[model samples]
Structures are given as structure tokens and as C-alpha cells.
Target: MQDCRILITRPEPENTLTCERLNTHGWSAVPLPMMEIFPLKDTNKKAVIRAQIFDIDTFDYVIFVSKNAARLACDWLDECWPMLPANVHWIGIGQGTTQTLLNEGVPALSNPGHTTETLLDWLKPARMRDQKILIIRGEGGRPELGNKLEERGAKVSYLSLYERKKPQYSAQTFFMLPDINLIWITSGESLLNLSEYVSLHKPEWKVLPVLTPSIRVAQQAKKMGWINASCANGADDNSMIKATEFHIGKQND
Candidate 1:
């Protein structure tokens, strides 16, 4: 064992899953979740989501952006839809989202890649014209998907199911773990939050190797002037581990 510590900054539940997989591979996982997810508490938004649930069959398409979105949205949908409305195309952005939706009884398909841009690439402007699409996501998520659909003549509505906030951590939080030599982040938000936390504690960590889920995120890290940011191509356990091994071997060589 190299005795290296791999930082996992994915939000909870997924954070635990990723950590377990890392431990099995002989890398110590630092499970400091950078963001905490909470369902929307505003009365108006809640009412709006409830209304959408009641009229779920009216939409031509629905998209789940994250596993949390799938879980929260389906939890609300369960009361109204005993069976999913037929003819509505359900799409989840990532494999993680697809699997979570499948677990929560929402049948969702992921065409190929996992980002919003990838989905837009698969969608034809002709197919979107006059279609009604509902995008379920965290509060203040990226608007490109909905905006692009609307521009293509599809009527798009956003269902903000939850919000993500950075979790509070004490200095003692870092005491138990060894030096963090590697970090794995799946999103730009996670990178931002984790960097803030690391700067507060270990500013020198700016030079530590980082593993991003996609090339876009890796470029984001680079634009921020971080060193050694590598793309793992996915957020799944196998993909993360494979990329981690490659980086570690490369470092040793």
C-alpha cells in the first residue's frame, strides 16, 4: 500500500459509496462531503412542485439532473403516479442519476455521455419544437439545458427539488486523516467548495493532484490554476478507480 489518502468530495450517500470502493482498492478515502443537499422549504415552490406532480402526465418529457433530484422528485411523484405516465420520456443525466431513479422507481434513460451538453447533442431541434419538458434539479442549477430547449421551441419548466450548500467543518475534521495527496471531484461546484475548504486548512494543497469526472471539469480546475488535474471520464466507482490507478502509477514512474 502506498498509504496515500484520496479525497472524495461527492455529496453524501454517494460520498459513502465512493469511499467504500476506494478503501477496497487500498487507498484511504477522506469522506469530507463538501456540499449538503436539502429539499426546498419555500411554500410557493413546494406548492408548484406538488401541482406538477398532479399534472405529471401532461408533460412530454422529464429530466433528472442528479441522484438527489431523482430521489426527491420521485418521492413527490409517488403519491400521484401509481404507475409512471406513459409516453413521457424520462431522462437522467448521469449513470448515477439513472441508477438512483431506477431505484426510486423512475425509469430513466442515459443516452451516452452524462453532461447537459451531451444531452443537447443527442436532442434534435425538430424533436423539441412544441414539446413540453420538465427539468428536475437542485435550486440554481445550470440553465443551459432548459434555455437551449426553450430556444429550440420546446416549452421548458424547471422543478427545483433541492438546494446544495457547503457543509461546515471544524479544524478537527482534518486531524484524523493523513495528508490528502489526491482529490476526486465530479462537478465544478464540488471543486469550488473543496478548494475553499482546503485553502482554509492546507493552502499548499493547490499543488496536489486532482481527478475530475470529465474533461470539462478538469479544465475548470486548470483555469483556476490548479496543478495536475486529470479527467476520469465518469463518476462511477470503476472509472474513478481506474483513473486513480493510472495517476498513481504515472506519479511513481
Candidate 2:
């Protein structure tokens, strides 16, 4: 693991932190962000997003899909809402999102598990009849979460605060691609974008070892023809680091 050069494909800011952590642990982590997160600039949409944050207390439950969602939504929440409503049940997809909420002075509930399916399972027994649910997330994410909640009789609404876009890679970065020993991908969209970029720029590197945070992401990589894809325990930095070390150990063995 110390000698391995890991390619991190998370979006910027987050990628910087992950790379720093990986470097602190002895791995040479190179950031090759596959996606970029940008807040919505449209005034109309921004107003709606702000209004949703301001009126979050009206909802019975508020769910955050990712740390980005939690952080970005909290920015507007902090501006509009002086105090958070105590009665609203705050649900986060995983520990990372939960911690982000806590850091923003918003306490939340989250399962140890990190997937949308897992969150749905945790909420299955709860009474959802006509309950108003607000989900804060980036634009154009999976609809399964909202769909499942609606099926359980919850009136689901989404507040898209940010959007994800593919990053523009430099020629120097492409030149260094062959040196990458492993790639860490956090989202299905990032994996897809990486695969597409490789297909166009460096197809032979498709055999590179790729680590994903969830089985669904691994499956998506496989479907994209990446045979070396594997799943980590969860999406957190520690989980990804441990999984990378385990994969490297197995390779050495």
C-alpha cells in the first residue's frame, strides 16, 4: 500500500481531503476528479431551494442524501432559519452526512449502513402515511429513494441545491494515467464518467484496479466493462482507505 499510487476520482475539495489522508497513510494519492460540484445559479431555482430550506420545519422528515447535500443545504438553512425545528426528524444516509449535519449545528439520525436501500429498510417500519418528506441533494441523482418513500405513503419533495458535472482533464494528467495502480470511485456517476473518459483517452487502462464504496457502484463498473472493480465497506474516507489496503495486501499475497 505504501508503494501504490492511488487515483482518487471524487469531486474537488472532498478529493483534496481524501488525497491528504491517503498521503498521510503512506500511499501516493493522485487526484483525478471525474466530477465537479457546482451550486445552482438560476435565481428561480435558488429561491426555491432557499424557500425549501427556510420552510423545512413544515416537513415531517428531512433526509440528506450525501455530505454535499447536507453541507450545501445547511448553508441556506443557516441563512434563513435562525433555529432548527426540534420536531422534524432528520435522516441522513450515513455517518458522513450525519456528521456534516452535526458540524452545522444540526443533529440528525443515520444508520451505520451507507446505502439508500439500507436507509429505506430502516424506515420501513416507521409510520409514513401522508407524512411530508423533504430530500436535499444534488441535481439529477437516483430517484429510487424518493420513489420508495412515496410508496410508503410519504409525500416526497426534493431540493436540488447543487449539480454535478464532468471535469476537464489536462494533457499532463492523461500522460500520468498509466502510472495509476488503483482508482477509488465514490459514486456511480463518477465511475461512469471515468469509464467514458478512459474509453476515449486511455482504453487500455480499463484493467486498472478500481475500488467503489458500494456493491451497486461495483456492479455499475462491471457493466461498463471494468473487470477489476471491487466494493469497499462504505463511502467514508476510513472505509475506503482500509479497503484499499486490504485489496493491495491480497494482491501482494
Candidate 3:
């Protein structure tokens, strides 16, 4: 772990936390955030999101797609709603998101895997028919979850609180790309952004090993010509550490 240099591709504060965690565990973690998160600045869109927060109690199921979503939604909820509805069931897509919801004083349930499919699977045994579900996420994210839920007889609504955009980086940052031992991408979008960066700056480094949180991301990496892409159990600190260990172990063998 000491010799391993991992490139973390998560957004700002989360990337810092992941780097610190990896460094504490004796690995060299580089902060190379591929995307940046920004609050919804458009007046009309902002008003819509706030309206959703005020009427959150109308939904039976409230789903948070990521830690950012949970945190941002909670901020609005705190300002608009004095108390969260007791009957609304909170569902977080992964452990990190679930923990964020819990920290915000919201009880939540999360699946073992970080993928949307896993969340769908976890909810399959429950009654979804005619239930109202509200999804809070960043702008322009996948509609698969909401669509699938709707197909299962649920009324789904979306509240987009933030926006995700590729970070603007200097050419010098790409110079260090070649020395990276492994690249850790948390989402498919990040993986695509990393691939674009590599293709434009250092095409040869595209062959470097990559660790992702879901099979969808791993598949995206492979489609982009990354030969050594593997998926971790989920998108959390422990899962990243475990994936890093597994990659290193395989290399040593």
C-alpha cells in the first residue's frame, strides 16, 4: 500500500476525505477530481427544488441518489420543513448516502451495492404499487431508477438540487497521470471524464488499472479501452480500500 499511488476522481470535499483515508492507510492518494458540484443557480429551477422540499411529506418514499443529493436536500428540508414526515420512508442508494441521511437526522435504508439496479432489487419485495416516490439527485442524472419504479406501479417525481460538471484542470495535472498506480472512479460520468482527460493528454496511460464502485462504471472504462478495470463491492471508503488491496494483490501475484 505504501508504494501504491491512487488517483481519486471524486468531487471536492469527498475527494479530500478519500485521500486522507488512503494516506492514513499507507497509500499515496492523489486528488484528481474529475467533476465539480455546484448549487442550482437558475432562479426558476431553484424555486422548483425548494417547492419539492416544502412538500416532501406528500411522497411515501424519498430516495437520495448520492451523498451530495442527501446533503443538499437536507439543507432545503431544514429551511422549509420544521419536521420530516414520520411516515415517509427514506432510501439511499449506497452506504455513503445512507450515512449522510442518518447524519441529517433522517432514518434511511440502503442496499449492499451502490448501483441503481441493486436499489431496485432491494425494494422489489416491498409494496411499490401506487406509492408516491420522490428522487433527489444532481441535474441530468440517469432516469432509469424513476422509470423502473414507475413501471412497477409507483408514482415517481424528481427534485434536482445541484449540477455536476467536469472540472477545468491545467495541462500540468496530466503530466502526473503516467505515474498513477491505479485510478479510482466512483461514478460512470467520472470514468468517462477521466478517459477524455487521458485520451487528450496521455493516451498511453489509459491502460493503467482502474477500480470503480459499480459494474456499469467498469464496463464504461473497458469500453473506453481501459484493459484493467474492476468493480468494487460499493462506493464507500472501505470498498475502495478493499478494491485497492485486491488490485495490488493481483499485481504482486
- In terms of lDDT, which candidate is stronger, 1 or 3? 3
Poorly placed runs, candidate 2 (over 4 Å): 170-172
Residue 205 lDDT (model 2): 75
- The root-mean-square deviation over C-alpha atoms between each candidate and the true structure, in angstroms, is 1.8, 1.3, 1.3
Number of the predicted model whose lDDT against the real structure is largest: 3
Q: Clashing residue pairs in candidate 2, if any?
A: none
Per-residue CA lDDT of candidate 2, range 78-154, in tens? 89988888889988897778888988888899976888988888888889989999988898889999998898889
User: What shift in Å separates residue 23 of candidate 1 from its native position after superposition?
Assistant: 1.7
- Among these predicted structures, which one has the highest TM-score? 3
Comparing 1 and 2 on lDDT, the stronger one: 2
Query: What TM-score goes with each of the models?
Result: 0.93, 0.96, 0.96
lDDT of 2: 0.87
**Number of clashing pairs, model 1?**
0
Checking candidate 3 for backbone clashes, the offending pairs are none
Clashing pairs in 1: none
lDDT of each: 0.84, 0.87, 0.88
Instruction: Between candidates 1 and 2, name the one with more favorable TM-score.
Output: 2
